[model samples]
Target: MSAPRLRRVAVLVLDGAKPLDVGIPAQVFSTRGSMPYEVRVCGAAPGLVAGGDGLSYHVAHGLEALEWAESVFVPGYRHPDRDDPPPAVVDALCAAHARGARLAAISTGAFALAATGLLDGRRATTHWHYTRALAAKYPKVRVDENVLFVDEGRMLTSAGAASGIDLCLHVLRGDLGVAASNHTARRLVAAPYRSGGQAQYVPRSLPEPVGERFAATREWALHRLDGPLTVRTLARHAAVSPRTFSRRFVEDTGYTPMQWVLRARVDLARELLERSGHSVERIAAETGLGTGANLRAHFQQILGTTPSEYRRTFAKGE
Candidate 1:
């Protein structure tokens, strides 16, 4: 009756590191009974490293920390487009990869990962602002600017600081299974699983024409997801005509009101599949999809997997 050994994770702090980027992995993989990870915050050298947004980091370990780590995270730094990472830092990252440690980059950290030449043949992403620069600087790397993150097996990259959470949760799910990852996400108050392939940004009209106009209606719909809901019903709640509601709702959320409702239902179905043992038929009824066949079709179209298959992959106590 011994406890499981913890995985070693190192957050490699580079000069001009972004604070949120450094904090994401350090927080997600922090050692605790609930999380089976031991985090070490290290720098290029054991000293103060300048940071972005007027912050800084001081570490107790240097590149040596990567030697013992099972995973090494490179947090984004400022002005990555201005210069290459230090040669020794790049070498250390390459060596870590050579030794079978997973390497992940957040935001502009992709610049440093690319500098090591390990991402030459891999698909990667960075904060949208830097995607073109990242591609121009490293022609050999396949830079996909649209995704929230990309998992190229040993090397992973995320679009921005927030997506770093999605990346870490992804890694956690792989190591501990969906149930555990979901529990951790609940603790972090984050979304349980946002597919890495999901777009980093969605088109939304700015200055939101329907701002707050239908916020209450949306909230109302969420609570009544299992019940019959329609454009007319939602419009009634919003005190508007159906035609006006449909037009403005699309402009507001970048989705027809029905499209928004369907996505919400699918998201609810996913949660139920992971946490509950209800049969697909029951889940379909509860999510307003009406029948098992309908649920399967929607799940296939939206998540690329059937409800039963999703349950098998992510259901609790499986």
Candidate 2:
């Protein structure tokens, strides 16, 4: 059979856009040509769109790009506090969304999506720093900064900066499959996956001192999910007392030590289920969830589905 058609992606660039937000879907989706996506940069009227830090990007397409796109991505912009996308942009977004085009807004791009009322009464997110503003500005929209991304069917939103990559990879995983998404991730030198429900903010407000060791500890944990880990053990690794570690860990990462570990194990289990032919019990043991029973329970609690169901949803070829 001939190769399947590539999906068209329109990256909507606004003034004061962040380069990474626009670059992410382009790079992550098209990097390996495994599940290649056709990425086009478009703007309100097309020409020169300003980016962060006095940089300017040229756009060869305009609003017309949305007409043929299978998905549209709104990159983060700097003026989310007050700026609104021109009426034309909002109207096109609504039309495209109504026609079943998947819509994703990165960081403050959610502000534009919210302005169009597309996210009304739907759970969504933006940069953690502006989630409050988003909630206040659009009371009907449920803003959740805690998640890396919110997959509300056709409309999606992601937290600040790097989370855009997470959302893009999710789209790839759902549209393509495990092996394809993993290929893209490997080409980009990024972690294979981060689940959408992963926490975006700390469990509590953090002091500067606690912030220093927080990320290092989490990176350390990501490599050790297959091992037995406890809050006390994590405390030892961080050189803090158990109580201090628990408090600081929650304050800095928004997840308890056990909660974080559970998510990590479940996420790893998902990848293995998608990529490998291993039995659920074997996968569970490998990911350190102890048994298939435990894995099923955690998947139900954290992911709202069973392991077998998840495997069926994302396993192997699409």
Candidate 3:
């Protein structure tokens, strides 16, 4: 008997679909690899679909193609005013779900999925800009505005434009394995694996200098992350009392000194995991988080994944 066929993924491109959003899945899933996936693009009808940028896409299949898919991905379009998807499109999605096909939406494409009622009672997300509107319109759906994507067992929704790449890579990782997904990421020159729950484009608040602070102290703390440098140590570096340093640190960076240190250590640990071949123990020690056990704990709390798993999914090579 022949080996089982690869899973079939159908991308539904509607009129006014943003070309970038529609193209991400096709590019990411169609690469030559050990874990290959069959990808197809479908439209309302088998004809040229106009993109939001005025370019026309030659879609060879129509909604009929969805019947055989193992999964369906819907890309976002430009029209937010027209909250409803065409009846044919809605029917195709509902029918596919009824047969146990997984459904995914990228960016504003979530609006289309939400319209089908499949996302009802499920936690999902979209671009922060449209999150409130999506919530108001679909009160049955639990909308989280901060995440990159929400993976409900059978359905998923992603955030804004480039976030589509993040979601597609996540799905690839989950379906294939870390190595195959990393290969695809290298081919696309994109970050192979971003933890799904990472915050999407949250602006970092700049630290304001309190009473009389200097850049010297901040740099000093960075150099001593692996040691026991507390708020008192930082205040000493700045020639101030620990109490004064505490208030000033928050005013400048919007974070307490320890919070800032933890974030910095996490960032350093991530860099080491991605760029170096060092063991988890060494990485943890160098970043000042201590042993591998401590590193794994912090990684899980901050990144929603274990250290080794993060390395496997994001490391440069095998």
lDDT digits (tens) for residues 184-301 of candidate 2: 7887787786543433133222223335566777779878888889988888888889999998878775678888788778778888878888998999899899998998888766
Q: How do the candidates rank by TM-score, highest first?
A: 1, 2, 3
C-alpha lDDT of candidate 2 relative to the true structure: 0.82
- Model 3 TM: 0.63
Which portions of model 3 miss their true places by more than 4 Å?
1-4, 195-318
Clash pairs detected, candidate 2 = 202-254, 203-254
Candidate 1 accuracy as lDDT: 0.86
- Tell me how candidate 3 scores on lDDT: 0.82
What CA RMSD would candidate 3 show? 7.9
Q: How much is the lDDT of residue 282 in candidate 1?
A: 94
lDDT (0 to 1) per candidate: 0.86, 0.82, 0.82
lDDT accuracy of residue 120 in candidate 1:
98
Off by over 4 Å in 2: 195-318
Better of 1 and 2 by lDDT: 1
lDDT of 3 at 301: 65
Candidate 3, residue 2: lDDT: 75
